[model samples]
Target: MENPPNPDPREALASAHRTFATEIEALRALDARLDDSFGRAVEMILGCRGRVVVTGIGKSGHIAKKIAATLASTGTPAFFMHGAEAIHGDLGMLTAQDIVLGISYSGAANELLTVLSVAKRMGTRLIAITGHPNSDLARNADLHLDAHVAHEACPLNLAPTASTTAALVLGDAIAVACLESRGFSREDFARSHPGGALGRKLLTRVRDIMRTGAALPVVRADTPIADALAEMSAKGMGMTIVVDDARRPVGIFTDGDLRRLIARHGDIRPLTVAAGMTHGPKSVAPGALAIEAAALMDSGRLSQMLVVDDGGLLLGALHMHDLLAAKVI
Candidate 1:
């Protein structure tokens, strides 16, 4: 009996490395080709009153969808259209105020050419991203962006490897340029992504999640420990907010503190909330994002925080669990 010889792992690793290096070199060459036409394409998209209609066929269509999503998420409204479908009936989705972005490696995709003609008839501005600037699609476009690469990353040199990567990068460049021209802020991005965790972090303020008014388990500094405990139990927040006579948060008393108080043989009826409370518990402004409050609670190892207004008046209270349920953390 005998064991088989092991394959050379080094050869496999070297082959992958070489492919990546070649593709990266292709991207570098594409970067060097960026010029005034790229700037003009961005300016045209920026001035578009309607959505940026991105159309391509096959592999380019997949890339166009991603590019359209990036553009929409970053404050530039955009959507992907299949070049073949545009000729069927989807061309009606476009308007004269819109800008059309056509993607083709050969700049001669028949489907794209058909839609390009419809776009022209509708008086829409056309921007072409292709490797061959002299090709039909590019020559007919109002602005032509040359995304030529020296060679494909594929050993066959026939697949849409380097060319697709170049197109994706060029689309990203256009999106970022439009974003800058429109002065799209982080707040603007947050507004468009309100259902995601990032939106919760940037847009969900403390007041939006805090338990306010009668829902807050609050006790005055002079309130007896037994009364405070009753309020905490009734509110089911595991803690009670301690406030001064002026309704400003002064301290906090939690269930853990109650255990310590009992261990000390304290008289619960005579002890005041101030006597058993941890002074100056972490607090946040009502206008602060809930995520910021969650960070403060996590970093400080606290379970809850009091929410206050500008003048230090108690607005409400927030718990770590509330943030978890809201997916704000």
Candidate 2:
């Protein structure tokens, strides 16, 4: 049998573009409707000491989870609760100090209505994000954020398309506003996401990752080049710290120094660490953030750096590889 001809790729792409354009128009309509109620929603969330419990049914539930995740990661304490589960005893997760955000397109989702009523009885503030402001959920809510869209992107106008996007965007706006109102800092965000790359970049300090005490490779200024190499090898770091008589960092000798020394002369003993060392090599404060140290290493083309105190006393040493191992980079 002869095969049927394939559909035109350009036609398919054009159809997809039309869908996006329609939805974008709906989103614009939704954005225009944002008003005083949006501000009230943010205020209620900021006033709550406990978590923001986001509950929604159907497609709104998926958006709610994403909003909750964004809020939790960005300094606001929040979690998603399914509207159906709230009536099945999960309502206990909410308290008077908490705030509840309910999402529903029709604003009459039976599951969400039940949860909103329970929150009201518990004296928890309720914020509603819905397409219908006159809907039951909106009427009962302490604050109503109008998420109404002109129409759905779906040709049938049944599946959630523009309305879901509007709800998601509004949720993000709320989270961001609350974050700013609370003066949330990068360090504060790091505290909540300590196990992630962002946390490592912001929270890891030089003192936490540097080699300390005897583990640090150190030698006197007058130590022979061979002794410096031994110290470097013993400490397993590529560099050795050269200290003055006062035991403060004066210079540093590294594998590069040994290569230069050997290129100068085969004799190693007469060439002291002070003679071959680079004076005042780059150093960082013990309290410096690990990401700052990483940036320093990159910009300065340094493989290792000595950590020092305010008085310039050697506290420890840090290698670029150490930052890599700690996932700070």
Candidate 3:
């Protein structure tokens, strides 16, 4: 059989608009419904002596997993337990000091009750994120967070849509509140995310990664261009810093400059490094973040740079490759 024609683009766009409008309204309603109960939930999680265990069935399970991850990443230690699996054997992961968070949009997921009851009996604290306050999950919970929405964005009103969005936003609110309450800083966040570009930006500094002292490709301003090129070749940084007699940086010469000079004339060995170098090239301090070094190199279209102290005296040297090797780029 042949397929029918697709709907009009205008209709498709209108459907998207409707869905966004419905979910946005759901979020506004949820915002109005917030009260001391929300604050109480944050307080319980903050004071937890053990990890927070989050669990749910179906769509709520996905939301619960995300909430658990956000909580764990933002300073609260948390992990998700599958609701159905918890009854089989996964409940051993929970302890008396733990807090169990169960999510149920209808407030009556059967798969969640068995494990919730077990956690309750073990003296573990229970928090419920539910759509119906009087549902079984809520009645059994120590604290209830209402995630009720007026309607689903789904045309059939059967699928989880606005309700899930509300639940997710509420989860984010809880995580951020917990993060602020615990005094979580960017540096602390870096420790948890040490493999990403953000970790390099926050944790890796110029001094830690820059080549210092003898490792620097350096020469005096009046040094022969051939000698400057030799220093760059020896250091393998593709560039050399030109300093005055006082050891203060006056310019920088790069392989690109060499190529330009060679392209213009063949016998360039007689030229002084001062004549071929870019005077007053930008430099960064040793204590700066390596990401800052990346910014300088990127904005100036440079491959290498000099590291100088506040007095403009050469302290070290670095190249864009250094930032790349450190993953700051």
Candidate 4:
């Protein structure tokens, strides 16, 4: 028994570089060959009344699944149906209103051909993505999208490397075209991905995280600066709201203000909060997005913000720490 020697790192690097170069050339060929057929393919998907059922076999099946997910997340209704399964029972997933997107570099996989036959019998429109335009799958398709690549990135030129890359990129382009045509918005994307960070930032409202009731630190303008500081400490918001008799916020005093006050007038025992409080503090409506509030606070260089009603009555407050805790930052 003998241990094998490590291969040369330079050789591995050279092989990788060659693979990338081959794939880049394949993609360039795909882009240059694009014509009115590409636009028509997007138009067909958009016009489809039912879901886009993506079907494929083997390696193309994995790419089909990714394409389905991208289309679904971007506002188009779509799902992947395995080509082999479709001939057995998954063909029921297709309907006359649905559009079939079949992926096969050779355009001659028996399983896909079976599914295509069934889809055609059901009157389902078929969009074929194949490297051979004259293949049976492409010739029989209602619309053909040629995914032909000059060659595979694999040194043997037998693996589905560059061909798969071309198909995946074509699918992505179709998804993006549909997304723009439908005017898919960030909020819409967030809605689809509610458990993700972007969703939390877009969907969280000011009222959801603002401290209200006893958690709020409130003081009258006439209150002593020492008492306002106590309120700030008690609420742990690093600030206190100075409100009028009607509960309308007239000013705000923060830890920063306290420091500036001590520097200006050392004898603060006789001073009122009004002397140190900032008049007309920034405020937001309770319904505003928490992310928007964060931006407002950032632009004003604030650590805390007041949430007020339309009548200017203080309802709640937000601390920078709150946004961080909620992961909205």
TM-scores of the candidates in the order shown: 0.86, 0.90, 0.79, 0.91
Best lDDT among the predictions, by candidate number: 4
lDDT of 4 by residue, 5-97 (tens): 888999999999999999999999999999999999999999999999998999999999999999999999999999888888988888899
Regions of model 3 farther than 4 Å from truth: 2-5, 211-225, 234-236, 241-287, 294-303, 306-316, 324-329
**Model 1 ranges off by over 4 Å:** 1-9, 213-215, 220-222, 243-251, 255-269, 278-283, 295-302, 309-313
Q: After superposition, how far is residue 122 of candidate 1 from its true place, in Å?
A: 1.2
Q: What TM-score does model 3 achieve against the real structure?
A: 0.79
Query: 245-306 in candidate 3: lDDT tens per residue?
Result: 89998888888878887887788878888777888888899999888788888898888878
Could you tell which candidate, 1 or 2, scores higher by TM-score? Answer: 2
Candidate 1 residues 208-280, lDDT tens each?
9999988999888888888898999999899998888899888899988888887886567778877778888
lDDT of 3: 0.90
Candidate 3 clash total? 0
Each prediction's whole-model lDDT (CA): 0.88, 0.89, 0.90, 0.94
